[model samples]
Target chain A: MSMVEKKLSTKTQVILTLLFILGMALLLWWADKGFDSYKQRVLRLIGIYAIMAVSLNLINGITGIFSLGHAGFILIGAYTAAILTLTPSEKAMSYLFGIQPWIKNLHADFFTATLAGGFMAALAAFLIGWPVLRLTGDYLAIASLGFAEIVRIWANNALTITNGPLGLKAIPEYSNIWWVYGWLLFTVVFIASLVYSSYGRALKAIRESRIAAESMGINVFKHQLMSFVVGAFFAGISGSLYAHWLTTVDPRITTMGPMLTFYVLIMIVLGGLGSITGSLIGAAIFAILFEWLRDLEQPFNFFGITVPGIPGIRILVISALFIAVMIFWQRGIMGREELTWNNLYKWLFARRKEGEKS
Target chain B: MNQEVFFLQNFFNALMLGGLYALIAVGYTMVYGILRLINFAHGDIMMMGVYFAFYTAVLFSSPPLIAAIVAVAGAAGLGFLIDRIAYKPLRNAPRISALITAIGMSFFLESFAVVVFGAVQKPFVQIFKTKESKVILNKVLMVGGARIPLLTFLVILLTLAIFAVLFLIVYKSKIGMAMRAISMDIPTTALMGINVDGVIGFTFALGSALAAASGIMWAMRYPNVYPYMGFMPGMKAFIAAVVGGIGSIPGAVVGGLLLGFIEIFTVSYFPTMSGYRDAFSFIILILILMFKPSGILGKKAIEKV
Candidate 1:
């Protein structure tokens, strides 16, 4: 009976997976054809945010590293991709303080530039993780935060490279739905598989207890560094998408501060930490809600009641809501539970049986 | 002679700043000592304290002494409430949950401030208005060729007094003993018939009060009240706490003073590199983390299975 149950479930799982892909494909086709530019932009942003959310989850959630340096990695990725993709004329126009001569001549297609961005960010994560992964918990968090701060400060001073505070402009708007969603899909699938693999189990073991994992002969440092580097690579990819989407980059602390890290952290937390599907869902909800929250900025009618607008209302609401979630509903939409095909099949079967009984 | 005066002037300025930083750093260290939680909202609480003082003196037309007291008291109340509301629930939860809540609370306070107090910078001035548009800022003293403000001496003296009182509390008082014991081992301390929750809340109050005092002094020196005013000083003070060995009061003071001295002297000596001054703290933080993660005065903890 158990063997028959397993075979039937596997068949249902494949069907569910195919259905999910078909639905997503339909939505993407609609997004390309039917949505206006504003709606399209939001869709692109959600995809990019999903990428960021899942990648960060790989480090902070699965690996349990509690790193706060995603912004620094993002910065590396953004600058690298932006610089590589910028035409010589565009670089000349943006670099008022004068451009780095070699970089001024450098140019690449969006694909190559994005890969370079990921590589550069991965490299930075490797260097930073070497000394940084040695620390644990809050110390690691602060050290990583310090790393981001240092990066921001460097960008602020590196006039020839980053163009200082002026930042870059008119580099080209190369990010679109296909590119953004494509990378996001790859990230989700890659991370989902990675989380279920033997190596991923080692990460979970490390997360649960470092000493225990070490005693069990798991190389704690190596696995953590690997996750950190991989997480950073996707972070860089997302940053590349973000830069091309926005067509601008700056070295402001507000942009690369622990605040952005917190935003990503909450996304994974809200989605349910250690759940890849949760990250995706959380990112979608966060991005859409944040965009929708702009209504709080000006007077608007809600169900025929006119509510006066308040400045900073969007940020205020998000922060307050974040606290309430942290306090009351920490498990979020999911609690380290993945929304897998098996679960979907079970839910559908349960509902059908209930309908027949009724 | 001019160069010597310049150095002395910067030295005095940095000393005063350091004193204020030490006051705030003590708040961070004390809370950390008790809770093993970083209390990320601490700096934002300081910002709120400044706002409290600003509103009281400006809107309520209160006396300077009354405003100062109100600020400190208000900050303490907020700290106690935050512990009650945010950190208390997560007492048994994972440390990461508590840390995330801390981060959330910090953002909540900052966003709340921005919404209530407008995002633009407001003038934070002397509560005691005189003929000049300045309070203590108007007064200056000359010792040798070096010019020093009276406020600098007052800040240093006040910091010293506060530190002495703090030392007395932690070392000589029963409650302080309780705090130290809890930091060493909370469960055992609780088992000893002590109210752990009450003690932790009280610790928050004391730390936040000190931060409020520092915030008031900081605003007096900077002469601006903004929603984000507490960020830089708060971050620097947290670094100061870590630098001195997070839970050590004396370590906080030493770290704050040393940081202030290094930061100011570097800028004074290298005007061309003043733009990079903020980077110094982060550099020091990384270096400290890499070489001596336990910090200058912090003892290393043993990991248990």
Candidate 2:
């Protein structure tokens, strides 16, 4: 609490943040040089998911808004990016039903397309949030889920623009470790800063007591809508990253049937609902586990015994893990605590000091 | 088919669909009424019921009525087990945690079904395939010079009978009184010497039994049993519960019937919009939440804050 200690702490934080950035850059370089195609793909996915999980945490965890329409925003971003980035000839080949004449000749570079995609998603979020954000709690969850379903149905039937489930193929592969990690870094810093700001305090106030927050002159609806739109914007960016990385986009990917939103939900819940550090760790754990669990679906031999592959066993295991986490570790791994140097120091060495003080 | 016949046939189909939805919606309403948690796995329980009936009839060569009974009983057991294992421990936790657990339970049951019963669709055995049963199901009646299948009448009658029985049990029986008391306040109910947990278990069991019946009836009409079969209907039924005012049994039935009519009429009148039929219920859900969050039959609870 002394001035000298405060200055020392700030200095340590700056040094630690710089070191972390350097470490990440080194990892990206090493990955570019050393990792196999599969490892690189997984690493890229971790970055994309980190962005997604953190953004979702901003809305669901920090703001206490139970919005489940993430897939709708992601779909808009994916389709926008895919449509814009596709070469005119590629568009012709993919749009079997027929391409719209106005957008037929349009094309953009990867960066421009991705930004446009994010903008479109944010715009959509703002419009939808105006009406949907009026609801609360479980009603909000179901209504948002319905909105996602409606988006999927629209994508499935809109032949001229979306190709009506035929889906776009051969999108240029423009996402890599640098792109994903860069976005991940931006998302974490931006959201963390936002969380630490006055607006972020207002959101937490609304979460804890809406009536009290309103009495304090906080515009609950406007703040909730802002958090939703911002979260949706990042989700859009992540979707663009995902689409460009895979080189394909489809309506099925955005539908609730595929369970993509559930996976994101599991990550946030597992990582710690309201912690940025938890979202990062949760995203990493989920991406790795998802890839590793494929072994459960593939036939493997153990001690000269042939075990038959069970195709759906992986999902079953994951679902069981989710239920177990909810039941036993309801606060999740982070429990509203962030992984900072000061906290780490306290956990390691300051316990004795605290005990003596007490 | 002539225009009149087409209209009549679709109208009858809507009635049957409504009956099926009502059956499932009642289960959702009952469970939500007691627990204040949406049992997401309710749909998968219906799927389990369909599979249970199919396996019992095929494996044991049991009579159709016996298979139906076994299926309903099995579904009730599963629901009871799910409540005990999943929802019971979280009774005092935040409602959001319980909701998340419900979603996880839903995912677990669905994926478990896929693993146990393969992902492929199986042709459901027609209970009415026998000559004697067909005579009853195939018996048609002329209404305004249009022939209506007797099976449609059977489904509607079955749904009504079940609802009537459920109504009597809930209104006239002591157990139903316990259920109502628990829904109002679990602690008070427990303090008053009513076994709150037992009533909740009974409510879950009853809901599961109804879901089973709806699943079997659905398979009888459509004749396709798959692991994911219950999802769409289950979601529609939940929407019905919400539309009808979530905790009210009568509201659920009305919502289900209204939804069925909307779905069927959308398809019949606007053929091109058939693919968008599923979206209609969700649109209605949003509208209902916007204008009447308490639903048609639900009593609104004032927020404490």
Candidate 3:
């Protein structure tokens, strides 16, 4: 508690922090220029997907709740961004009643559109979460899923905002590597800090045992709701990123029911639950695997013989892989352990240890 | 000679729709009654049943009775096997685990079917397509002159038959007593030397059979059969199960009938509000959970913590 000791500790901490930042900056700077446009696209996609996976971790991993409604938040975010950023020409033509005069031509930039989408999604989540979050376990899951369906239906019918089922197309592609990674870095640091703080500890406590947490002076509903809202906010941001990246937004694009959510869940589960590192690695692997498998959708030749129906073959193979992963690697690759320096070292040194043992 | 007939017709249409819903609702109710988990894949199972019926009909090509029997049996077998292999082992895991598994199985089945059946919509031709018949009522019943199809009457008859069979099995038979005993307290029934697994398996079989039958009936009404057809009805049936007291047999029937009417009336009265068809049921569910978690006619059980 002495002033001199505190000052020394602060200086040491600052030195370590500077070194860490410098290291990361050097790595990103090096990777940025070397990465081609396509590689940059992949990185941006990873960043957006990482945001989604991390936000979902709040619900499924941290909270021990299975929610199939993450896509619902994404849908809200997409539509919100579309409405906010589209030009007056688009607004005037799309709107049968015509756009509001003041905000008609109001086209916000990428960040503002993303923020608008996130906040709007957060607002929607707050409204829906209040009642539905009360139910626990499967009841909560089904109720949330139903709520997502309702949001989709509302989006489909609300032509004034969403352009009905035809969907909003011709969105600007503004989600580059920098913006995507910027948001990802913000979310990662924010959530990681939150998890390490007292509030994060309390959230973990609530997840461990709601009744016990309630008895121990934690407000279960409030904490759960907060997590839901924050998680949904990040999901919304990811949604906006997706919209900008694909240059299109459609209610129908996100209307595949639990399929997208299921894939995301599988990624997190396969990576390892309750681990941010797992989610990041899992999302990257998933995106790459998906892209690789997409090639199977085309006709190919094996030793000069032509193959037929490659897309159909790919679905069966992927589904089978999903089932195998579920049955065999239940704890996933990371097994709830973070990819911290020590863990990574241990993983890398596994061969040495095995040799010593031999 | 008035609009009264149309009202009667719509009313009858609603009733028939309710009957079909009740058929699927029973499966959801029974499974939930025993397991206390929503089988997210139940709808996809019903999809399998429809496909089974379709293929069986194609195979027999004569005697609708034989084809129906074969399809129902095939569906029942598939349901039984799915329960034995996928669900029974995971009975003791966290409800979420089972739920995820259900979702996985649903994906597996739907994708598998899609691979085999293709993604195109196929029309389901009834073994015997009946022409519309006029129902003569003493009073002039009409809802803007919507005609009451005689097939609606057949559905009513089928619904009555299903209820009668379910009632006799659940209340009047020894196996029914065992089922009720297990539902009330599985351990106690097991302690009393009743085979719990057998009863559970039988429950699944019964429910799956009902689902298969309902799938056929639904295909009859809707006529189009696709790999993903069971999803909407499955969801509505789950909602109905929740609305009607989940574990209560009679509740499923009532819930189905109520949901059918709600969908019909909502579509008929306010076509613009038709998009809210599914939303209304979910809202009802939320309200029911908030106000009365046990649902209509469901008995509340206090947990002894």
Q: Which candidate gets the maximum DockQ versus the true structure? A: 2
What is the per-residue lDDT of model 1 for residues B1-305, given as tens digits with 9 covering 90 to 100? 68889988998988988888899999889888877889989999999999999899988888777999999999999999999999999999888888889988888898899889998898787475655436467688996788788878878888889889989998999999999999899999999999999999999999999999999888888889888888788889999989989999889998999889989999989997888888898788888888988789998877776
Each prediction's whole-model lDDT (CA): 0.88, 0.88, 0.77
True lDDT of residue B209, candidate 2 = 95
lDDT of 3 at A351: 34
Provide the interface RMSD of candidate 1 in angstroms, 1 decimal place: 1.1
lDDT of each residue in A1-358, candidate 1, tens digit only: 1323322466777787889888998999988999999999999999988999999999999999999899988888999999999989888887999887988999999999999999999999999998899989998988898888888888888899999888887768899888998898889888878888999999999998999999999999999999999999999999899899989888875675667787888798889888889999999999999899988888999899998888887778888888889888998887787887665655567344334322
Q: Interface RMSD values for the candidates, listed in order?
A: 1.1, 0.7, 2.1
lDDT of 3 by residue, A1-358 (tens): 1222112355665676578667866766777889887776777787788898998988788876667788889888887787777787877776664444665667887799999989988998899888888888777887888888888878777776677777777787888767888898888887888777887888889878888888899988888888888888998998898888877766662243456677677778777778888898888988777766666677767789887655454555555676566556666777667776544544575334334321
What tens digits encode model 2's per-residue C-alpha lDDT throughout A238-355? Answer: 9899898878777873242337778888999999998999999999999999889888788988789988888888789999999999999988899788998877875676444334
The superposed Cα distance between candidate 1 and the true structure at residue A144, in angstroms, equals 0.6
Per-model TM-score versus the true fold: 0.95, 0.96, 0.89
In model 1, which runs have C-alpha deviations exceeding 4 angstroms? A1-19, A302-305, A350-358, B1-3, B126-128, B132-135
Rank the models by DockQ, top first: 2, 1, 3
lDDT of model 1 at position A95: 91
Q: Rank the candidates by TM-score, best first.
A: 2, 1, 3
True contacts kept of each: 0.75, 0.72, 0.44
